[model samples]
Target: MSEWRGVAQGCAVIVGVLLAGLAGAGIWIAVYMQGDPQPDVAKAARSHTARAADLLVTAHVDQQLAQLRTALPWATHLGTTVADICETYPANTGFTRRTWTPVMCTRTGTAYLAFDGDFREHLAQLDTALAAEGWKPTNNAGDQPGLVADLDYTHRPPGDATAAELAEAAARPNVATVRYTLPIPSTFAVPPGAGGGPFPIGTVEVAQAPHLPTIDDGTAAHDLTLETRHFVDWQPYSHTQLSTAYPAHGAILAISVRLPYNT
Candidate 1:
């Protein structure tokens, strides 16, 4: 009888083990059927999140484009007006091919303006104009709304300085100065405010040869031809291409030449 009881107990133990195995199998099957067989819940969530973010960005971009379209006409008109007033070409004789748009200049273009003065006077005047106009210098991309000014100027020190010395001077910390060159509309001439000439019309750009790498050759062979242009489109006047090498950091020096009072 003891032997028979022991056999029965053994049988019961085997049955319990089998039942537990079956139960576990069933649970696993149920989980499998529920979904996510591969079980990459985190990845799926990330994909969905990425799609949603894309949609949001697309919507906002469309809205911004719409806004820009609405304001386009006024902006164009302003540009035309400025270009007309500050005709890129110097009003006075002797300036060739408009505001030194290109990097290199012929000997005549780069030559000193009379024995009495250099380019600093124009820079100072431009700086004054920018301040009066309430424009600030900047170096942002063109797509964004702002002005892009390209400026370059070089100072010839007393006596001959070695290339190393010149390079040092070029790299020295810049003393920020306001510089502007602009075309004043015909409307702003002949009053208490507008008397002498074309009132400053565009942004000001005051920078050295290295500062305007686009224009600066680093050769120091030629006289410094301060060549900078204001992208007076819709954007505020600023340094637009400091990041690019071919375009160079200070290629387009910026200045905010203010509009003279309209008579």
Candidate 2:
């Protein structure tokens, strides 16, 4: 009986030792499966960078729109409408290939107010206003009948580096550059006798750098750019009887801002 008790105690000790070994092995395997941590750190860095870029771009866009609102109160109309007509045709062979051409026509109309008085004076006024805000005239085609001036401004955002770190890390390149045009007339050409032909249209454009740095390994960076046309007033006569009623004014703003990484 004593020998049997000894054998049972020994068996229990062996089982405990085996269980402990297995638990340790499991832990080691789990740690090994986790792989390198550097990739995760890089991913976090990219996410931070993208978020920073997006915030910078949004602020810049808002500033541009605000300036526009102040400088051109007459530009009350700002929106866009699109019309598409589709027709079907039989397939045909051409150049040893058979294909059917898509039958669709899309028309977009934008309207906005131009300066009511001397356009040149208005342009000068706008230039002065923008100049006060650090914008400069990159090109001036004011002599042209329809086009006026092109203004450009560069803006840099605060860097991620701490103040104690190298200033070079904090000194980033231009995060974004905005180019806007001041036109004497509208971008749209109203048909003869259109009710709203007298009003001028103006346009603004914005373009910014990508959210992430371009990689040499063939990865593409996400960028942002957009153009908007602000109209003076609506034109009801331009629409056909079957068409929907035109809004009170005609304008369109298309804005796109892209960020590269997930948070």
Candidate 3:
């Protein structure tokens, strides 16, 4: 009877040991199957593919060309409108801050950004980036870089060569370089009938630091006042109409002058 009991105990101990070994083997297999470490080759291949894709894009700009092709016609009208905003700011007395606020918030508006910076003297700089993309920023101490100002383009009758001579002598390389120092008025006003005499009916105090040359560079003309009916609001030229982004900003001015290039 004792021998049988001992034999049974020995069998149980062997079974226990075998079960423990099986459990240990199972744990080892589970750990091995799970993700243990980063896969070096796969990571390297993925990085290489990303770099290749970037290179492929840089090597080709057809995507940009395609986008421009679809957007050019609209861009032309928008550009012209922007030109009007700039050309007319100094002329309109009825324009308000609300209307001109977005003038410098976008591309061509950026060109006039500086003007906005100092309202006492000028409007916001028009961002020319839209019209002249990637063009370097320009500054000429309040002068619009290429603007031709004070240019008398009208020709005299056959006898008077003086007018023709003056116009010829004043021809400048870049019309935009013609700088104008406009007098800041105490108030904005237009009296009785419209479109008469020295606009704005106020004194324009010109800055004397940079002396005005004998030939007018369009730098001294300042007191501007536009008639109510002739006044054009800046709305259709907004980003919505201009960009694929937002709506057109309100307009504040409109200038129709024949300058150097017929001005």
Best-fitting candidate, scored by TM-score: 2
Could you list the CA RMSD of all candidates, in the order they appear?
A: 23.3, 23.3, 27.5
Q: Which stretches of candidate 2 lie over 4 Å from their true place?
A: 1-46, 80-115, 140-263
lDDT of candidate 1 vs native?
0.31
Residue-level lDDT tens digits of model 1 in 1-263: 99999999999999999999999988976665543222232232235443343244333323322333243221111111111011112322342222211111110000001111233444444334444444343434223223221222222333587888788656653323332233333322322423344433233223333453122211232223322212211222112323232222222232222332110
On residues 1-263, what C-alpha lDDT tens digit does candidate 3 reach at each position?
99999999999999999999999988976675542332232233235443343233322222322333243322222222211111212222332211211011010111110011222122112222112322222234324331211112111123455776756654422112232222212232222233333221111111111221122212222224422111112222332222322123222111111110000
Better of 1 and 2 by lDDT: 2
What ordering of candidates by lDDT runs from best to worst?
Answer: 2, 1, 3
Better of 1 and 3 by TM-score: 3
Candidate 2 TM-score, true structure as reference: 0.28
**Model 3 deviation from native, Cα RMSD in Å:** 27.5
How would you order the candidates by TM-score, starting with the best?
2, 3, 1
